[model samples]
Target: MMTKLRKIILIPALTIVSLSGFFSCGVDRWPEYAHQTALDTWILDIMQQNYLWYQELPSYDDVNLFVEPASFLSKVKSKQDSYSFVDSVMATPLPTYGFDYSLVRNPDIDTAYNALITYVIPGSPAAQAGLERGDWIMKVDTSYISKKYETYLLQGTKAVELTLGEWKEVEIEDEEDGNEGGDGEDEGPTMEYRVVPIDEPVEMPAARIVEDNPVHKYEIIESPVKNIKVGYLMYNSFTAGTKAEPEKYNNELRSVSQKFKEAGVQAVILDLRYNEGGSMDCVQLLGTILTSADRLGEPMAYLEYNDKNTDKDATILFGTDREINLDLHSLIAITSGTTMGAPEMLIRSLFLEDVYPIATVGSSTKGQNVATEQFINEEFLWSVNPVVCTVYNSQHDTYGAISPATDLKVSETTIDGSTNYSEFLPFGTFDKDGKSERLLKIAIGVLDGTYPPKDDKTPEESATQTHFKVEKSVSSPASRRFSSKGLRL
Candidate 1:
């Protein structure tokens, strides 16, 4: 999944200084155009010929030609086009030198956003400075940060100071009910912050790991019916070996597959509940591992580009050469509205294969059957990620969202030390307590044929199912393992 704290750096500093002058550009090589109008012109030009939803794009005269690039993309973007988007790298680029935090509106402070240090990349400046997950970000520098300035705080730079804080809760009066314990108006609940001191700014190293240190965790449990063994894997993102960070993701996947094999699992529960897509290579590799051996070396899916680039379209294949294979006949997927990109692609592709059936249990899927390629100008100053193709399954089916076979929304839970703010269980901890997690319970029922009984679903059970009280704008592909499906210079 594209984390608020990425394992990779998508955008680097662009110091180019040109706009009107012609660029040494080709069909895909755009110039480092600096002016808003020229950049928009370039973006619109690219999208017009390349975007999968190019036909849906607004006319140049219909939208502002010189607004922020991100805003311009948003304005012309089709509501149906949920996956295609411009990252900050091409628009308002953020830095990566300091710690990474997922900032959300502070429920207590209207003006401030609560920050969580999701995870710290080891050996990075943030780790060297003693930063890690479960740390509350108290302040950026001098004051508590506002949501508007979140991008500014996360930019990649040579040096940036951070003020980490501790979590604290205070009591305040309950105004909605107009009632207090024994008094008319007393404190009920409030979140207060204690400032952290930063005497100086910290300098950072030259490079950062660009691909996701993918969060892959798996566990094994016995099925209630027939004593079948099942494997549960929580996959956060799909990534493969990159030149800069070779085997970072593929290796993790292989390792997890090995665990499932060693455990003698008869069935596998692929948990993509939070994954935003990543590398196509990694996605296909995992699919290969999940499918049976007879299906290998056969056409799995096809990638079709626009008419202009028929040469670029090609058939995807399933293979049997992986270190280990589950050889699963059917996969039980735990998904959510957040399930997207390659994850969606895998589900649809497997369903089309007919050999390896896919049964999903989660909320509605985030239909984003689009794949984007990152293009950088000859100067390497500006980059653009435009939709290039629409993925089709083995049956030549195209889609936006793939509804779950069984829609069971399971809310995340907080253990003793971990809070819902971050579902922390050390990735893949085997709960020796023999108690199944909420989602696992339902998936187990599905495996054992005990799901969907008349009384199986109740108001109390439905309440415990996963839900977000706060509204989140549907996440875009830019956040999913920010990557390209093609090779780049």
Candidate 2:
């Protein structure tokens, strides 16, 4: 790789005078490795050109660039940056079982545990195998799962067969039924109810490279408010399709807008509770859809880069007449700790517009007010994602961990020997029993104020939120990347 090129210093006097070897002119004539691996050099060159905190980076000559590319990147990155990292070029979407899980101990056995499914990627192997967000894996292959073997759960490039289990309410005859052996004060046939696992084995195929459709689900829902409808969208990621077809997912978002327009929805429910983030273009485009038509062509958001890349700093505008724009009054975002980056940016952009109130339903979002650009070197088979710029709304306003109008902590788990089946419900407009998830129910309640099923207790009292207590996690690397890819441009 070093044989590929050369570096010409424009200012020889400066290089000779200053032993520091600082590129005062900041200009490189050609490809230069300078005793460093081509990968590491490329990483540094890209970071110098785009990193938002490039001024804080150590000089190229001062840093050890001969180390591994990932290590070199770590050494050079600014101390404030935590989202920037290096990975294989396949980080766009890696092969996987397509599900993330938490390891919980088995109540019956101290050593044994189960992998509780947290979220499954749509159209992935886990979803195809009839696995869901609330399912459990009691055993992997023939061995019962325990914390010791948790690292091997759904990992590597091999096929895995899992034994499934679910919590069910079962009746058991009580031994102490108030009967004193023929004294006979029997309280009928005493039975104790307990929620225990009904184990069933399931065969899961090997991992495969699966493309995720960030637009998980979209539909027009009849609102609890009389004669009004709401546009509901469950967006998982902000991905703009693959490198070859960048417009694929963006086009799908436009189609969603068209449907919402046709439905004449008065309010919108944007479900981004699981969305981690994606490209800036998708964020701007979706912002256009949610914003009132009058706000079109105005500044949606802008990027602030380091001093060296000020020329690259640009403001993203709302879509024009060519793009789909909704005339809705307000939007309710379903967000959680998983929601970050572009999704949060979109919410703030709309809120700053003041066209209408933008209310959030779930918990606060993951604070990521910065954007990253992926630098993929096909020859080196490496991709470097460095924080390139800070993102702000049109008003130059930005925040961390966007708070919700109605704060609710929601999660899923299966605790055997307990009676809690509420978390086992599916995520959709409505479950099999035609019931909305807690988040959705609360979002609707925020809009119409007729939620919580009109129970005797107040809406606040009736609305109970619970979270999963995860002792360990068996989350796949692919799942982590999907949710951790912050705002991208």
Candidate 3:
């Protein structure tokens, strides 16, 4: 849906500089106007008028506005709200290891844990050191993984030594199996895998700013079925572009869709397993690319603001990017719990008028059907991106969590008969040896009508399944932060 930036609500400048003028005298130069109270007052004023849950806001008298803006906003915010937040406009971006990791307790060693590399950005130090998604980190510096070292993986910008390891399955014959001659069981006990450390430690350089392109990878895949070409796009974020080139990434998306159309792609798969969400402008652009021309001018989705700001409520309509629009009946969205905010809105919008359906695969989404507008006080170097409205598809439906049409939460079996979780493969490739990276494979299956395998669990049964356990997960700062970017309009 093409939705333009409708308005910019400029709060009266109540920043430190403005207050500084009010406290001009030497005797009482730092008066009430220059205190945290004024800043908090400014924040409250905006939230009360624009926040989606304005009615649930705490009374002004009950909040301790003397506290820092972050803490003060937290105190006054509605308990139901999790996406609203205040950020320092002058804050520097956090340097990162460029790889996400999840910690899992080592069943073989009591209280010991291992870090599983979740995903590594290309050209990052982790990739330079030859780390892949399935790799493991057994120790951090000299400390083995324990409660004390559980959070070491998240120490952004810190130089650290990582002891690499591998997950291996060792067959342990059951003492009661009695294969020698007694009543031997038909099969051995379930196989188990253990993490074994490598001999040398990897010297991980200090975290640095790694340039990540939201348009990670795109390709035209030739399906096994004759006369069918599938477009696979692994999109990690919804960012439009940098300040210098606002439409840079959006232009790239247009190029990819044009390529797909030229290649006669019959189906498209959007892999958003790691996307946490970003600008709604990009969402509208991508939605337009996937929708059919006949669907153009239809309501893709709409934002519902609080009563005080009902005038801001707007519907995003599907528009044509004539050169690239695919006009497909349906498309696939590969999602995980990390997919949220604008990405969720994009997924819901695909169901526009029920004329086009989105076949979502993988795990449940993060369920953030809300959009935020950033209010910046540039003079004071502060900004607040508060959730201004709840988003809904044309059908007026908002999901608690967007469950996948197919779920791939089942565990893999090791050679020793124990269960081990499968790891993500590099984008676009399927594991012929095993079922790892099943999300993309299943999506491809849907296009070929071979999905669900006729033997696999139904979507309903799979929805109740739980992912394999990990002690803790650590994604890049952007992946963990909500409303990191805002929908401009």
Candidate 4:
């Protein structure tokens, strides 16, 4: 392969390789030699022909021959392509330890950090372990959870021994007498670290918890000050199901939309803060569901393929939905760094189709304008989610990440490291449900003038606010990019 490639003078544009040899019958269907180098060569060949930015590939001289196929693929693609990568569809989305978390840089000590418990999946190990939202994980298995590289062990570890921390109020020290500070005002609570006993041993194992309810929440909230009723949908992903039929997943979206319409929803708040994108088919359907009948059959996005597959270019139009013209027109979409792929597409499509302006709040989205094509080795055992095409809205806008109309400092943030954090209370929390969920309240406040509206910021501007990039993977898994085709229950 090297000799043939050198003969052809391999360059950045020489990404296309003859893939006819990949197909055959029975055992021969697979490549005969089947070495790691051969596999990587095959991947490179396919990518050159299919990757949206084929011309951006590294030159043959720059290719690292010793790296693994997946790692090599990462190196070959453009630095701008954050979403394109290889991974397995088989690895379970269920956390090994049955807990999901996010790590934030500790502000007090810049060298340290904290892993705040984001969600304790209902029956997951974290929940069963008595771990709740807002718990700051100070250490896992005696390894301090700091900005240090070793802290990543928590995500890959099967069993985690945790040293937890909770916020507790502290009295301020006065400058003169060391009592209550100069003013009488009390200082805020601080994070005191300790270990908490779980139902199981200190260590938790990887397992699937109660799987349904990925749709964390869908509630009709009534305004406290005004006589307006609002709908809020916390859509995590656009999956139809993990193993169930796509129809079942579609029904889940339908059910939520139906309830929102029946509840006489005046304005809607669509939350896609943590979503890492999913199926384009689902995106098309969601665009239809969110849009009104007046815009039915209109183009939401145009999917264009590479030069070799231009025939696959398509115009995805908004389909008709049951709740055609509900009082919901323009909506308030709460987004974050993880807001990407299909969710980003949905927001951009809706905004382009003029169904309504999706007033995005929070951070800028994961700027992934490209979609992956599901491919596999001849044996079908190894799958590859390779970037194959680009998507543009009706107006031919290829926005990598949809910027928020208003920038809001509402996401969880650590102030002075272990001292304070903006703990994100879940939707529908008693006193903090509607106007309480940090990001959601910003949307309502801006609309109703309860809070002053800040100037709309660009993606670059909003990105400066966050140290961590909102994404799904803590690190590359055995085989995973970010999104796997699934039905979101």
Candidate 5:
């Protein structure tokens, strides 16, 4: 009996040893590469530790992971000492509410507080009561609207009665006196009208015609010098639809381009002044269409990574699986302090190729050149800011740094139409006088050959030709003196 029991235990022990050996061999065969240098090891170590804070945070598996070996290694070198890496990785938008409203002001009633327009829809109670733009709204049932803040409560579709303090309708009245031929002076009679709230289409700016279709609203302003027309295409955001959907934005852009071509426009000015940024593919597509063929194959940008953790061994990855060749010569992008994300990419690509940046105002770029791939699971959405590729200019400068070809300092007055030019400085402290305007004028000058060449003029002449001086404002105790251009007191 002892011998039989020994055999049974031995058989199972041998089987377990065989299974362990098989698994160990298989694991050894699996590919595992180590870092080349101690610096690389250290970077990986830090990234792994930092990643733990976000591991349990959430895991999203919607999209496949994309790694660019070159960009990964480049970033590791460039951002070794920058604090922005940590801040950028942690930045997130907090949840918040968004509200939309329209306001109409009235000047007539003592209790004008009650003259708030509520539920004013066409063919509804308000429209039926003859309430229109500039009509004095007195009362919404029993509520009073003294301050603008009170109008927030009347947002949804709800019926409410209103009372008008007074309404004036301009009309001609006949004089009871028979002496009609004598005095020519006549005052119009005023009438009162009331209305209730109802749903109506809000009137908005009409979309202008580009090509044959009415699309992308734009303005064609004549250049200060003749024969050149500046076509301003104000693109707002690129978030129109997903990748699978047809690109409506491209359609609009094509239409705009066709119109520009038809109008014999010599140079186009793409105003990305307030653009925050959106889809990368959209930007790329637009670049393809706008750039010339000669500017296509040159290096557009270089990507840098903080850690060299990619398994791929290639230096350059192009297209899909490194198959797509990017064409970069199609656009001249305008950047401002407000330009960020993919918009920065567009500008950086142009800058790398030595394309004309035209005019950049406001502040320096936000400097977030890394790409992100988003993942979504049942529980949460995970957006991983991965250093996929280092965007390099033709010279292979990686760290996506954007110094304006011509820097312009933008102030609030610039956007409000009060200032003609921005100062060409980073911060608002330095005054550029008309430097911003000069840069734009020079860009136009380059295309037209009207601007004086640097070789033809002395340094002082070049400086004088580009600079415009504004008189300094005098400061007083109560208020500062304003410019005489009537830019408002």
Candidate 6:
């Protein structure tokens, strides 16, 4: 009986294996193998086609005909020592520099435009003329408000008159009453006030950075909305210092989160606008901390092949093992075109797991959801270009889903450097004529619990009951019941 049972099980297992093998074999051929062979053949063909005089000479081993030892020796002796040459080049001192902090512009508001301030250094001549921020910059010297004038004004060195609002050229001098009031006690410096709108723009100092200087720098900006604080940490790139590790990234994020919690911050906005992606390990560590326990072991994404080639083609990927229990009070992760690689993964993970609803206000994402491993030929040091290790979000369902969750599109009309949040809200993609202001109003109404939800009755239920015809825009994408928005219930 046992022998029969074993035979029965083994026969079915073998049959299934055979079927799987047959099915897999029927799939298309591996593209990488074909690609590599084609590339090699093309290279050889090109080399043969463009045979130079150098190739006409005998091989290196054919010393009898090709070798010129005397000439080669002479050439070597004529050149400087390689070690000495390299050392001399490396020994040169680097230039010293510093950054000017006089002028400040809101990065979100002024995308690429660097609006200059005409404020000179404290000891500089521009400061002597007096220039400050918020002064309505009319013109530099002789240039008017035109584009050419703006450019010319920027080029000018002389002082420019800035019209100050209301309080200008006002100074209050203290008068001492020496006989009765100031006779008993020594009166210190009295209160003095001065309001002067200097005509010239300030010539700010040049910006620079020291080679290996160690200086702690940080910025604290209070959020316009109540109970929200934004802390922006800008690092040039992740591969900066030698000792920088995964813990460094984790510690920084944890410290910021702790501070936010202490400050009673309702929401934390992690501004990674300038952060070019670094170590994947570091990104994983961060994700672990930001994510919750329920989502710890869950598959963040799968990395599989498009073709049914081999078992090695499949890979099940997951976020780091580290898990944080703390509530991730809404994460406002700011991203731009520059954000790529691991940064993109970080943003995607945040959205996928519902850790924090992402609101990408600026621009679209740089869609590079693939990781690769490089192999170099040891003898020639010629690298076989990156072998794709894993394709991200390979589940096929969420491959091209890197768009923003809120759908709050940002443009020039919505953004300004002023504190008017209302202005920002009342302007989005809803108004094609630039006058409708419908989307913003709708958003505001929704937020205020005033926008009524659309009634979506089923066909079967409607058929049973008395139905009335409803006039709706048929052209709108949102009209379909099972639309992309999934808002219709």
Best by lDDT: 3
Indicate the residue-level lDDT of 11 in model 5: 9
In model 5, the worst 10-residue window by lDDT is 480-489
Whichever of 1 and 6 has more TM-score, that candidate is 1
Residue 434 shift from truth in candidate 1, angstroms: 6.1
- Let me know the TM-score candidate 4 reaches against the reference structure: 0.72
Q: Residues 1-489, candidate 5, lDDT per residue (tens digit)?
A: 112111111101111223244356458521222211222333334444332122322122221112222233334433332221211111222111111112333323333342322112223333445554223334445655545434332322244454554322223344577756777664445332222333432222211211111122354545555556555565645443323444555566666666666665655556554455555555655454454445554444444432443342112212221112222223334456556665666655555334443344334665655543322111111112223333443345544434454323433223223221232211112112333333344444444456445475433321112211221111111011000110000
Ranking by lDDT: 3, 2, 1, 4, 5, 6
CA RMSD, predictions in order: 8.7, 8.0, 7.2, 9.1, 20.9, 25.3
Local accuracy by lDDT, each model: 0.62, 0.70, 0.71, 0.61, 0.37, 0.34
lDDT, model 5, position 292 = 45
2 against 5, candidate with superior TM-score: 2
User: Please, what are the lDDT tens digits per residue for candidate 6 over residues 1-489?
Assistant: 112111111101111222244345578444423433332233233222221211332332332211122222222221321110000011122211111111222222322122223112222333344433223333333333333343333333344443322112222344644456445664444332122334444343322212221111123334332323433333323331223242453455556546644655443344443344544445555555455445665555444422322344533334544423234534555455555555566656656444455555444556555543323233222222222333454133334324444444443122222111122211122332343233333333333334333453322321112111111111111001010110000
Model 1 CA lDDT for position 456: 44
Against the true structure, candidate 3 reaches a TM-score of 0.81
User: Where does candidate 6 have its weakest 10-residue lDDT segment?
Assistant: 480-489
The weakest ten consecutive residues by lDDT in model 4 span 1-10
Candidate 2, clashing residue pairs? none
Give candidate 6's whole-model lDDT: 0.34
TM-score per candidate, chains pooled:
0.65, 0.79, 0.81, 0.72, 0.42, 0.40
lDDT of 4: 0.61
Runs in model 4 deviating more than 4 A are: 1-36, 55-66, 89-95, 103-114, 138-164, 172-213, 323-327, 352-355, 378-380, 406-411, 414-423, 430-435, 453-489
How do the residues 452-476 of candidate 2 rate in per-residue lDDT, one tens digit apiece?
A: 3456553342122333356865555
> Best candidate per TM-score, number?
3
| Candidate 3 residue runs with Cα over 4 Å from true position | 1-34, 152-161, 173-191, 198-201, 225-227, 352-354, 396-399, 405-418, 431-436, 455-468, 478-489
